[model samples]
Target: MIEEIRIQNLGVIGRAHVQLGPGLTVLTGETGAGKTMVLTALSLLLGGKADPATVRTQAQAAAVEGRVVLPADAPALVRAEEAGAELDDDGSLLLVRTVGAGGDGGSGRSRAFVGGRSVPQAVLGELAQALVTVHGQADQARLRSPAHQREALDAFVGPQHRETLGRYRTAWAERARVDTELTELVERAQDRSREAELLRLGLGEVERVDPQPGEDVALAEEAERLAHAEDLRAAASGAHAALTGDEDGGTDAVSAAAVVEHARRLLDQAGTHDPTLAALATRVAEAGYLLADASTELGAYLEDLQADPRRLEVVHQRRAELGTLTRSYGADVAQVLEWAAASGLRLLELEGGDQRIEELRATRDGLDASIAELARTLTLGRAEAAQRLADVVSQELTGLAMAGAQLQVVVEPADAPGPHGADRVEMLLVPHAGAPARPLGKGASGGELSRVMLALEVALATAPHDDEARPGTFVFDEVDAGVGGRAAIEIGRRLAELARGSQVLVVTHLAQVAAFGDRHLVVTKSTSDGVDVVTESDVRPVEGEDRVRELARMLSGQDDSQAARTHAAELLELSSVGR
Candidate 1:
């Protein structure tokens, strides 16, 4: 609820500080006394458009500030914190808006601040939804809107119905998703077929080659060995000859094995004379054995080495085939094999595209059936709630002095399902008995429309809802525009009733309405003269005799008249009885 409002240089309100509190607070004054400027200040705080013309003459700028107390878990509070707004020491949010005077008589710029931190005007607008509901004469047009009617009926049905509506919306969204997927699959059937064909061809080529994990590397090694077989054979033979001197004893030099054996015999003969000679003989014998083993291995290698052109050509052809696979698919045989495995899986999926499409269609059909059922459920729920709402609001209209009027909340089938439902809800008014039901504003006067709106609001508020769903403050701008007498009193009573659970601010001219206010503020205008004459307006709360005089002024335009004061006191007394 708003705790206070401070406005400066705005309209006729040069500087005014209006203190507000819980319950119904009414603003009243004589014509041209700047009562409307109070609400205009509120509008600025609500992020309404700013007009430079609203800036007081000779003022550089117009500014409005508001202090609102909100619940700890309020959505508006959460949003404000998200925007880096800080709460006051008393836990109230401070909102401020300023409109600069345009230079050279052009349009001016507007700025908004929440909790002392600057924010976008749109942020203020977003917070306004949960902060207050403002009803003006122009809002009668909004009441006639079909969408708004649906929303009103839904709100009246309470949270359980809203949960049902949420379920239907979720199901509808899922159905849309399924339908989109099904359509895409059907439209791309030929593309899937072509993809499958390409995968199959690639797999066929890979299977024909039958490449192994390391085939390319192994083949390259074998090819190198075979290509140099002659050189390998010749090198082995030369090494063997050197190790054994010569197998045919063709060299004049002694064979390595024989030379070592001779050295061992000489050392043994001298061992009888010197022990050191015996150790040398043992080392010479070990060398002779190692030379014989080397000669045997070399001979074996020479025997195994051979040149085969046919085998070389076979290895080359195999390498070329693997290269072909590598060029298109991968870098080598191993990579090619990996690609084959992956493509095989892809081929399976592509081949099953037709089956998958059919499965999707089946799923979509099931969802369609479920969605249709939920839509019907929503329609039925709304229809039932509409009747209850109409009954209640019609009763409200009766109390508002439209004794024979009736409210008809009509629910008709829509052309197709929407996110809301498959029904169009409209509120029709029957001005009196035996009269045709007409859409709101069709045959109803401005006063009747105002009553209908008020009745609807009261009826909706009768339903239980948490604070988040119901705003804490409501502002009415002349809701008693064309209303008078008992009807005006009923309007005030309803406003007071609405305020039992929230804060209510009404801009009114009727003393009956003013009498119902828990707090009354009156705007007074005066002209001050100095070097230049200046007109200023101030808003001050009235009480006791002052309130009575203000109410008298509102009633008969003569505060000193005894008859008017008596009537004003009587209205106040009547308004107090029910409280």
Candidate 2:
């Protein structure tokens, strides 16, 4: 419920503060006295589009703020909290919206705030759903739309029907997904088959070679050695002869081992005289042992080294084969092995494309069956709900002075199931008995359309549903337009009745409608001239004779006229009795 609204520099309203409460509150004034500004302020608070043209002349910006009280578990409260907003100690959430005048002929910029925290304008729109419902001439225009008609009927069906509708929507989405996948699989069959054939050929080549990890590196080393076998043997033989005595050569040259052994013996004899010579003798002996070990290993290497052309040929052939595999698949055997492993998995998948297509076909068929069943449930549920809604709204129409009029909610089957359902819901009207039903847009006048919208809103509000599904406040901006006399009075009475369960605010010109308000506010316009001249408006509550004078002005052109005052008093009395 909106507790109070403060508007500044918007339209003709320079500044206005209006207090609201939990009942029907009406705003009335002369045609140019800025009564519409009140509803404009409310619209801004509700996240309506802002225009720089609506700002007062010479004002920098326009701002609107509202204080709304929400229950602890209200959806709006939960959303606001999630946005890092805090509530007042009294559990009231403050909403603020501002439209800044764009300088240099640019478009205006709008901002929104909830509970004193800045938020996106769209967040304000989301909160508006559970916070308030606004109806005006535009809403009556929307009532003529078939989609809006379906929405109204669905809202009136309560929770169970809503659950059914939700299930149908979910199933429809799943069916669409499965259908898309199945279509792709069927369309790309030839492409997948060709891909599978290529994978099989590649796998066959890799399996034939059967390369192992590090085989390429090992083969390269072995090939190098085999290619230079004779040179390696000559080098090893020369080193072996140098390290030991060349007995087969019959040379008198001393070998490295023999020289080091003689040097160690000479140092050992001199070590009897000096300790430093003893350390030198031990070092020479260690060197002689190392030379002997190297000579033995070199001799073994020369013995093992043999020039075999057949083995060399085999190594060369193996290397050429590896090079062929590398050129086609990878830079080396390791990379080729990696490619083979991944391609093997992919080949299996491509080979199973036909089986996968069959599986997807089965899944799509299952989804189709489920979707069809849910669509039927929705159609049946909506048909039942349409009848109940039509009956209830028809009863409301009777009270709104359309006694002979009847509302017919027609649900006809569409060619195919849509996102909503398989039915096209429309509202038709029979103005009186013995008349054929016609669509609302073609049958009802502007006044009748307004009443129908009002009737539908009242019915939905009074329907059995969870509190979360119902808005806490309802605002009507001249919903009583094109209506007068008893019909106007009935509209007021029904508004008062609707207010019994929720907060209602109305901007009206009719004294009959204004009389039913628990609180009546009057907007008065005045022009001031000083250093800067400007026109401003003020909104204040009226009661006793003040309210009567305002209502008198509404009824006639003269508020001082005793006859209009008397008429206004009578209307108030009649409204009280009706209430």
Candidate 3:
């Protein structure tokens, strides 16, 4: 709850410090006397919009600060710490906002701090959103939106729909996830099929070519031989002719083998006469045998040296096929083979799209079913709680001076599921008999709307919440504007009752309302010199004679009048708060 508020050079107030505690504290003053400035200060601390015009004429900047105490483990506390805010030793949070303008004619800029650390305004906004709700005429406009209506109804329903709301939220989240994945898969279906087809075509090409490892290198060597076949054959035949006489039978040439044979015969005839000559004959005979064996092998090679055009053509065709495979698939036959092996596994996975799609569809269908079930459950829970809420709030309205107010919590089905549920909840009002029932958004007056919200808050305070935690402060910035008489008194009573559980601060002009304040603060303007030379507005806590004087002034604009004093004294006696 807010412990204190400090304002410096804001609006008509030069400097003010308002100490607060847990209860209904009322701020009252004459028109334009700066009672609203106190609320403006608190609003600034709550991250409300900043206006340069709100700054005092003599001040360069306007600043508002608030001291709030929260649980140590609260989410706001954690976020403030994350933003590097230093918490008080007692775990209180310091919230501050300042709006400054340049000395020249320039627009103003604003800054915010949480727990004494400078932070973005948005961080302060988030913390304020969690801490307090400021209800006034502006918020009455917000009450007209259908989304807000649904939110109010949900909050009123409380723990009744917590479980089903949780389930619906989970199912809805899963549905979104599955839907996204399924959409992606379907969108890529054609692409995967095209990819699979290309893989199959490439693999088929490789299969048809059937190039073996190292085949390219081997084929290149074979092609070289075929290209120079005639040249090779000629060279071989010439060498053979030198060893033995050509097949053309040229007897004029003396062949190497024939000369060796003649030399051996001559040596043998001489070796018969002398033993040394016989040894020379044996050596010559060995030379003749070696020459004869080589000549025979050369003759066979010459016969086999002829090349065929058909064989060469076949080799060229095989080489061309291997070349095509090498260029498209890989630089070498081995690499191409490796690609084919990997492609086979990839192809299997790509074609498995159908199975994956089916699985997703199955999961999506199950999620759809679960979500529908949860929606139905949430709707039933809301329907039950809505009736109970209507009855309770209707009772509260009766005490707030609307005896004939009838509230109807309508649970209408939505065409599609929403984040909250499948139903759109609206609060309908029938002000009296013969008054047609209309949505509170359209039918209720400003006073009635205030009471409606107050009634809802009261009912919800008693209802169990999922966490059973309440906001730190309830700020009613003259939400009691259009209410009066007993109705105003009831509003005060309810506020005082609410303060029993949490902090309540109200800016009101009604004495009936101000009389119920546990602490009363009156904003008064002090004048200097004659006529309207200058004036200053000051706000401070008042009690005893000062409080009676303020209440008397609020009651009849006559603080010294005995009749007003007597009435104010009676009001004090009648008030429930200080009593």
Candidate 4:
């Protein structure tokens, strides 16, 4: 149910808020009083096309917002969640729309949000259909949409065929998945073969290099040592000679030994008197021994060192190969291996596609047979449901003053099978005897079409809907058009009957229809402040003097007349008892 509609700065009406109640609510006003603006605001809430002209003059923007109460299990909640929104615990959906940017002067935009989460305008539009249906001169033409046809039929069938349709849809979804896989496999089969060969060749090329993980550091150090081998040997030999004071023939061994003995004798003489001097003499002896050992090791190292060009060439070749793989994959051999593994799986799948195709063909054939059977069963179910729907619709038409107008549900073969079935069904009508029946799109007039649409809606009122979780609120802009007197009275009564389980709002000029409303709102125009529109609602239960005055004004444009008041009073009394 719609809780309230609040609009601001949108065309002629600066600001207006309407609090709606559950029953037949009527809106009556003089021409051009902006009564239609209310419908336009509702259209924006339903994701209708936006026009910059809707913005009030000198205003930067226009806005429309509405609050709706839904059932706990409403399908609208599921759609909201899919769009990354949540609903209130009380199942209220808040919708908002804004138009006209600062000063760009372009077509304004609109958006919807649920529980403070933004959603696509299309998603909100789909949900809005379940919350409200608008009937008017041009807007009522939407009743011809194929989607509406399917939905109407679904409603007519109720839950009797739900499980079967559910199964059909599930199988169709799986079939689509397989078809997509098959198409991709066929497109890439040759490419995968070529790619697999390239991977194998690349892997083999890198393997031949046999690159070690840390070998680059080790090889660089070895190359540096070999590059300066001769220089290093010369430096080491000079150091050895300096430390030993000429290793070959610079000093005699006996002289060196004598020096050492003299130093020790001097230390011994002072040792008993000075321990500090003895410690210095011991350190000099140890240093002389260390220098002698270093000279020996350096001589051996210099002889062993050599430069090898062949070894350098081998190291450079391995490094170059490793570099290629590193650039192609990553800076590591492990990463290259991982890439190869993933590519191999994809390659295998592609290579074996022909075989997979054969297997899928067999499965597809079996599914085709199953779907065919289900389609036939669905057609049978629709045929049965169609008959019952036609009967109910005929009954509603009679009450809506469409007497002798035959309503027919025509089910025919589709050019191709759909998820629902292989048949297309639509409502057709023959307005009178001897008149050939024609499809709704081709037959009904503006007012007749509106009434037909209403009949279908009333006939399809089953267990409400998952998206609504309750009966939808119906809004009729001019449902009573081309109707008057007894016919208008009957139409009003039928609307009131529909309101027993759902809320109904009608825009009409007919006093008979207006009298049936449980709540009445009148829209008036004033030029005192540059042509503003205002709507006033009488919240109290209208009866006796007040009801007669309001209906009298609607009837003859003069509520003060005694005769008009008397007639209006009689009309209300008759409607109350008839209802």
Candidate 5:
């Protein structure tokens, strides 16, 4: 519940503080006394949009503040904590909004703070939704929308409908996902087929050639050696002739190995006289052995060398095949291998596309069956709730001087399922037994419509729903507009009855409504500094003689008149006795 509201530099209200409490509180004043500004101030505190034009002429900024009291475990407190708001020591929360004009031509900006902690303006808006519901002339207009009508009906149906709605929404979301998958798969069927054909062709070519890792590099080196086989054999034969005697050639006189052997023998024969010569002979003999081993290996290499054209042709053919694959796939053999690995995975997905489509379709069908059953249950629940709501609202209207008014909540099947359910709800009203039922807003006077809306709210409030806390405060701006006499009295009584359960505030010009107020406040205009120079609006609680005078002023536009004061006193007296 909102405990207090303060406004500074908002509209013509330079400064005003309204200390509020529980039950029905009424604000009344003469035309243009700025009684509406109090509601505006509360709206600002609730994160409503701020208009720079509403700022007082000489003020650089406009501000509104409010104190909201809630239980420790209330969802609002939870949300506030999530937003880093700190609660007061007494557990009450303070909300403030300031719109600064910068005292320049630049457009003004608004800021919000909750529980003394600065937060985004949107956070304030969220708390406001759970804290208050403000109804103005705009709300009466919104009641005409079918969408709003359905929402109202669902709210009236209580927690069962809310649960059903949650289930239906879950199914709807999953069905949407399945539909997306199915559409993608069906749309890309031809594309996948084309892609699969290309992959198969590439795989077939790779398989036919069956290229091995590192095989191409090894084959290139071998082909280069074979290409110069004749030159290689001649070079080895020359080296071997220098190492040992060449049997095929007579030009070579003595081989290196034979010369080294003679030197080693001379060294061995002189080693007995000089020990240094023995070490020299051993080194020469090792050099001679190395020369002989080199010649033997060189001769074997020349024998093994081949200059066959057939093998050379085969090597060139293999290189050409590998070149075709490398050019199509990658810059090198390694990169082509990577392409083959990745393409295999992609091909697997493409091949399974049809199977995936089948799986999604099956899942969607199963969900459809469940959703259809849930929709049926929701429709049944709505039909039952609608009947009870209409019956109770009719009973409430009878007390509000609308004895003949009949409210009908109609539920019919929708062409398709929605997030809420498969039913379309419409609230209809029958003025009397002979009259056909029409929509609530149609064929009804403004006063009659206001009573209907009030009755609906009362019915919804009295019934227990989910633990989700509703706004503890309700504000009505002239819902009694275009009303008078006994009907006005009934409206006042109903407002009081509503306040019995929660706080309610109203701005009114009717004395009958004002008389029912547990606390009466009056907004009066006065000039500051001098007469007729500058006017300001003042809001203050009225009691005793002052209350009677204000009520008299509302009753006959004459607070000083003897007859008006007497009537105002009588009205207050009767209202105190539940009139």
Candidate 6:
């Protein structure tokens, strides 16, 4: 519930703070006392659009802020925490919005901060939806909407029905998904045939290539060796000739073994004094042995150094095939192998048979049956709830000076299955006996609309669908606009009754209604520092003479009238006993 509302430089209000109470708080004043500014402030606090024009003439910005205290179990608190907004230990939350001067005829930029953290307007608006229900002239008319009627009916049916509805909706959604899949299967049956052929062809091509992991690297090395075979053989022959003398064709005719032996003898004579020469002699002997072996191997390789054209062609063809598959499907040989396996599996699924279709049909049937049964159960629950709701609202209407009105909830079959189930509900009203029953919007007067809204709210509050929140606060903007006398008193009584369960705020001109508030506020116009401003004063628990005078002023616009004062006293006295 809203604890307090503070407004500054907004419209006719300049630096005013109105403290609200826990129950019904009524605001009343003369025609231009700026009672509407309070509503405007509430609107801004609830994330309504702001305008620079709402700012006072000399002010640079307009600001509206509210403090709301939530019940321990309220969902708004959960949402607040989710939005990273701070909350007091006692579940109190604060909402603040500021509007500044516009740059290009646009409404000044507005922002909302929950606790002290900046929040989007949408987050604030969602919180407001659960915290406050505002019924203005337009909102009263909206009660007749079919969607609202459904929501009200659902709310009236209680949580058990809601749980059932949720289950039904879930089942229906599942069925829809399966139905879509089935439809696609049937529609693409021919297309899948062509795709299956393509997938088979691709699989066969990849399989025939038989591309092995690491095979590409090995083949690349082997191909490099084969391409340089001529250069390799020439280099090998020259090296062998340098290391070992050609048969009867080279000088230094002693075998490499004989030269190494001579060097070894010279080194032994020098002893360890020439360590470098001795090491060189040992290395030369090892080199001589290595050269002798290379020469023997070279003689065998020269006879077998010729390239095979067929083998080269085969390697190139194999490489091209692997490259084609790599470019088309895989990054490399390994990836191509994995792709082939997965495509084979997908191809098997696409090639559906009678058995597969039957299986899908059976699943779809079970889902459909569950949803349909749940829908019927939901519809029956709605009918029962609607009957009870109509009775309660009708009773409330009589108290609102609509004695002959008949209120009923009409449920019709849905055009198609929907998430809400298979029923469409609407609120119908017959203003008087023998009058044709029309929809709430068609025949209800503005005052009647207000009363109907109030009655519905009262009903919904008493029987909330969710345990997380009951109705928090109800706000009526001039709902009693065209009412007076007993009707006004009736409105006040209903509001007070509503307040017994949830907080309520009503704006009214009727003194009868205003006098019955648990707390009363008078919005008055005054000149502050040569500027017209609107302010509020709490008139609850008003005393003898002052109470009489205030009521008199509200009644006849004349505070000094004796007759009006007497009437005011009598009205308050009567209201005290009635309440």
Best by lDDT: 1
Q: Candidate 5, residues 1-579: lDDT per residue as tens digits?
A: 899888887776778888788899999988877777788888888878887777777678888889899987777778888898888888889999988765576358888999888999888888888888787767777776668888777887778778878888899899999999899899989999999999888877877877888878988998998899889888888888877777654436678888999999999999989999999999999998899899899989988888988999999999899888889987767777788888889999999998999999999999999899999988888888888989999999888887788998889988878877888888888877778999876777677777887887798788768657357788999988888888788888888988888799988999988889888888877777553111223678888899999989998999998999998898888685223
lDDT of 6 at 229: 81
lDDT of 6 by residue, 138-235 (tens): 78767868888888889888989888988998898888888887887778778888888999899989878888887776777767767888898778
| Model 2 stretches astray by more than 4 angstroms | 12-15, 32-41, 50-62, 103-110, 116-118, 214-328, 331-334, 524-537, 577-579
Candidate 4 residue 155 C-alpha distance from true site, Å: 1.6
TM-score of each: 0.70, 0.82, 0.71, 0.78, 0.77, 0.82
Backbone clashes in each candidate structure, one number apiece?
0, 0, 0, 2, 0, 0
Q: Which runs in model 3 stand beyond 4 Å of their true positions?
A: 49-60, 102-109, 195-352, 466-468, 525-537
Candidate 3 scores a C-alpha RMSD against the true structure in Å of: 13.2
The better candidate by lDDT, 2 or 3, is 2
lDDT of 3 by residue, 1-579 (tens): 888888887877777788888888888888987877888888788777888888877568888888888877776777788999987888788999998854565358989998778888888877877678677778877877777877776776666567667778888998899889889989999999999999999999999988888888888877787788888777767767767866544445778788888988998999999989899999999998888888788788778765877878988999899878789888888889989999999999889888988999999999988888888888877788889889988999998888888888889998778878889877888887678889877889998888888887788777767433456688888888788989988888888888887788888988888888999877777654322111223667898999989888888888998898898888888886856
Clashing pairs in 6: none
At residue 468, give the lDDT of candidate 3. 33
Model 5: clashing residue pairs?
none
Ranking by lDDT: 1, 2, 5, 3, 6, 4
Looking at model 2, the pairs that clash are: none
Misplaced by over 4 Å in model 1 are: 9-14, 30-37, 47-63, 78-84, 98-113, 116-123, 195-359, 525-537, 556-567, 577-579
Candidate 4 local distance difference test against the native: 0.73
Error of 5 at 355 (Å): 2.1
Q: How well does candidate 5 match the true structure in TM-score terms?
A: 0.77
Writing each residue's lDDT as its tens digit, candidate 1 over 83-183 gives: 99999999999999999888766458899999999999998998999999999998988887888889889888877778888888888888888888889
Q: Write the per-residue lDDT of candidate 4 for residues 299-367, one digit (tens) a residue.
A: 787677666777777767766776787788666666666666676676576667788988877777777
Candidate 1's TM-score: 0.70
